[model samples]
Target: MRARLPDIAPAGSPATAPRTFLRAALAIAVLLAACSGEPDPATTPARDPDASAEGQAGPIISIRSDPETSAVPAWRAPDVPVDAGNLAQRKQEAAAALEADELFGEADDAIPLYLALREHAPADADVATGLERALGAVLQHGDAALAAIDDDRAALRRAQEIAAVAREVAPEREAVVEYLARVERADAAQQANRSGERALNARKIVVAGGKGAVAHFREALRLRPGDARAMQGLAAAESALIRQAELAANQDDYAAAEDWLAKAAKVRPDMDTAADARERIARQRASRVGNLRDLGLAALTREDLDAARRHLATLLRIAPAGDPAAVELRRQIELASHYGLFRPGQAFTEALDRGGRGPEMVVIPHGAFRMGAADDEADARDSERPSRNIRFDRGLAVSRNEITVGEFRRFVTATGYEARATRRGHSTVYDERSGSLVRRSGVDWRSDYAGKPAGDQLPVVHVSAQDAAAYAEWLSEQTGHEYRLPSEAEFEYMLRAGSQSRFPWGDGAPPAGAGNFTGALDESPGGRHWRNAFKGYGDDAWGPARVGSYSANAYRLHDLAGNVSEWVADCWHDSYRRAPVDGQAWINPGCADKVVRGGSWASSPEQTRSAWRLGSDRDTTNARVGFRVVRQI
Candidate 1:
């Protein structure tokens, strides 16, 4: 069920470029957060154990697209007080402890002490008060920082929606900025662990980190000023328009406020926050005498007396001058005297109710990339002949890495899923030195490789399409969500992540860290390197390497192009000419040939192309063929 290919790094492989390393490092940074600070036991939030991976909180992500619970009023929790003397004493004690290698308790303990000081300190206090205040802010509202991330993620989804609507319109920057900034921010936030001030630095990197995320967004508009993502980002920055509207309203600049709010509403009408802003604009407009008359007339025409009454009450707030319309304004005011102002915050109260985890899935953005073989790419086969352009939809969640052996085992134990190759079948285990294949004895999911002990983080191999499907179904049932083999399109979309290059990484073979390829193994000695290519006895170890044993793709998806061939949901189609344009698995009622993707560890370079497509019977199984599951959005 679980298998590991050997790691054989080649000697003197080129060192990875620093910029690329930083970029890759930023993308995977989230997973590293847990290991940074000591887990705090003093202030623990009640976390749901059955929470989905996307929604789980462990110093990183806290909210999902839909929160399972309603939002609690930002309640003020109980606080303990401390005097200036005690505070100073504690700081000195903490400094001494840090000198003695006891920082574990500092970040965790310092938070509460600082929070108490903030609650009781003078408003104008400086120096020590300021320092403790900042530290407390980081600790006490760490959740807010976490929630800001949630908002940033929400803004991304909103941007995608607008992009869909404006597909035909000129570019919008607000949406683009939010979308790019989010990916860069989350990626940096996730990786800020290597350095001591990473969390603080994460905020700074959002100011431009990954591969010029901010720069590309800006330049796209420069190149084709109407590009969507770029315009979206600009729109996001100008979001201050809404705040300006509120300021106008406070200054009784009703007309200007209305104009500004109307623009805000039109810009992103579907967003929840925008709706709230619109309600405020309505209330502000109602307070004007002339506006009240207009509202009353409009309400009367619609026969909504309650709305007319509310408008009139607001009209009387500032008495109108002695003009001809004064009598009418008073009449409207009297009629609307009992009316109440629209409540802005009510809509979001249950908003959290509708919330659980936002998407509970990561969004792998869309783009075009080559998906086939390359020169010097070994293991050429008929199915992998030509590379082609593969376009993916804007947002999809590819597994952050290959489904680890440990994760796979959890599925097997829970569903009792069986591997078909392990069931009354045989597979050829290639011998690198002899250049010969030996039919390995005995097979079945549970019985094959019984004596071999390998890591649970390795890929699960020897699985048929049916086996993969069954496992997916089992996972779905257990999780109360749909889980199944990714459709051929979905698999390609994920493998490509956001790039259109030949491999999951880019136009050419990825650098050694990008994957566990033959060249990579030839570069490293002593330590294990994923034997990506077959050069002879020493080139490839001829086995599945650990999942994520090598480098990850642009989206941090591991083993996407190699390590093992994965089963996809669709039946075999020689060409994508008639493939589904909407990114679904192409299923035919009578089709018996299943699609398999990503070359296996045994496969040479040529087989790993993005467009390489292979067909196998539904019942066929082999050590090289495995699977990764996908959740429909």
Candidate 2:
């Protein structure tokens, strides 16, 4: 094979070299065919590897053997150093492209291109114009998107995206900032509206109406003014409250009905239901007034004064004060109370005594007391022994004051009756010369203890028991009432009042000016007979000063202690062994000595005790004796 290769060589070349050359030629042909499918490496533009790595697009390459016959794929150049003219031309082309497609929100496509162009051509007007136009297009598209979408969250997201682009592109655009704020407010308003709707649906019906719904609706209106749905919800809530009020009223729950009605009125005062409810309530109250009036009248007819008063008061509260029935009921109640039966502390004047011009009389309540005196009483007489318990079965009226000289004179003048003392022309009087009491002729009921003229206000002393009885009988006839002297028990009871002491005032010495007892007054010129006056006691009066010369007892009767001795209905008894337990007068058919009670100015302190008693001849008269009258009701 080596000898055959040497014969193929025409020159003096080696045969192995020819074979190597042919092998190299074959490799070149394979390489040329591989490159023929792609553009020629020498004719193709080179790409900067650093520019490509920096997020820049690959450079646009153009290779053409015939300019009109070949087409090149469109491409974006990698970001690179460029002249001002070329950068300007590129920015204008980009802006024109954005204008054509309106891909204004395509920041990644357009914004970076303009910024890269601006880096190369910092003062290029076309670059500046393109950048501004791109930002404007972005904001305008955002506004359009916000307007297109009905959802607030969607609009807000779109607006935020646009705002981000604008901030990077043109951060000083006032309209973009304003549009963002508007979107935020719109979002808040929409959120509030949703919350308000939920609250309105979730509200509970209560006595105070739908307060929750009202608050929510109001807030909704604040965020979104004049919201028709919120207004409608509020109206519905008010209507619901009014309906609740109506139901309560139908059930006769007037208080609850009123509460609901008030709530409705607060929401809408012009609701017709509230007005209608008020009218119905008025009718119901009017009917109740009628029922109450009937009850009051029935009670009055039954003589239940307290129950009648209660019902009538209720009626007045329900009915108007000017109602005729209420006025008449009040009048009836007053009339009944005025004519009621005798009770303790009740006071009235005799109608027959010149039409309520008679002496005032107080009703004494029926009670029991230990009559007479204790056995250890210092000055108690034998007639006051064996203190008995006497009870008054019925209340009686007694004169508030003793029979005055003026009152007795009226009885005498009307009846032309002569008193026993006047007929006798002699009475017991105080004789200053002898400093003792003595019988003085010409001294009668009209004379004082010293034989001086007595005033009409002073008590009519020197009256015998028979005279006192005669006067009481005359007054009874004049007044058409039963009047008589108090029983011995009644006399002592009235004198003691509620006291259990020696004196009504207390067991101590009588206070100065307590009553007209035998005191310093007797030391006066015409009062020398009171030499045994109680020590440390003075009333400034020798004898009776007036009918009420002393303070009254608890029963409000005056001069019951020491102004004068009083005549009682009982005949003189030695002891309480046979005393009447019913407080009636104890009298024997033939007993001529009547009982006298209470002490006079001429008596000592011991004699002035409540239980002290004395016996007096029925026809005998004395200056120190007087009487009070009692009447049966």
TM-score against native, each model? 0.39, 0.47
lDDT of 2: 0.64
Superposed model 1: Cα runs more than 4 Å off: 1-361, 366-394, 431-435, 446-453, 506-509, 520-542
Tens digit per residue, CA lDDT, model 1, 1-633: 111111112222322211101111111122222233212323322222111112212332111122211222222223444576676665554344323322122232333333444555636254245434333332222222223322233222222222322221212445434433443353333222222122222211123242222233344444433433334433442243454455566655555655665555554445665568767666554445566666664674455777877665665544334432344534434433222221101111101112222112333434455554554454545454454556544334445555555656666665566566556556544444444445565554432222144467666665667877886676566656566777776777667655555656655555655554444445232344444453332323346676767765545567787777888999887766556656668899888899988776656565666666788898876556777776543
Query: Candidate 1: what lDDT?
Result: 0.47
Local distance difference test scores for all models: 0.47, 0.64
* lDDT tens digits by residue: candidate 2, 1-633: 111000122222322322111221110011111223322333433222111111212111111221111222222323544465676566655676555533332333455567677778778787778777766666665565445333222333444445555666555678767766655554455445444444433333222332454565556566556644445545654554554444454444556557776765665455575577667766876676767666765665567879878988777765665976676567556555433365455577775554335567887655668877777767777777888888766667888887888878777776788888789888888777887779999888888877787889888888999889998887787788899999998998888886777787888778866788887445667535455667777787776778776777767788788888889989987788867788899989988999989887777887899998888799878778899899997
Residue 288's lDDT in candidate 2: 68
Clashes of each: 65, 0
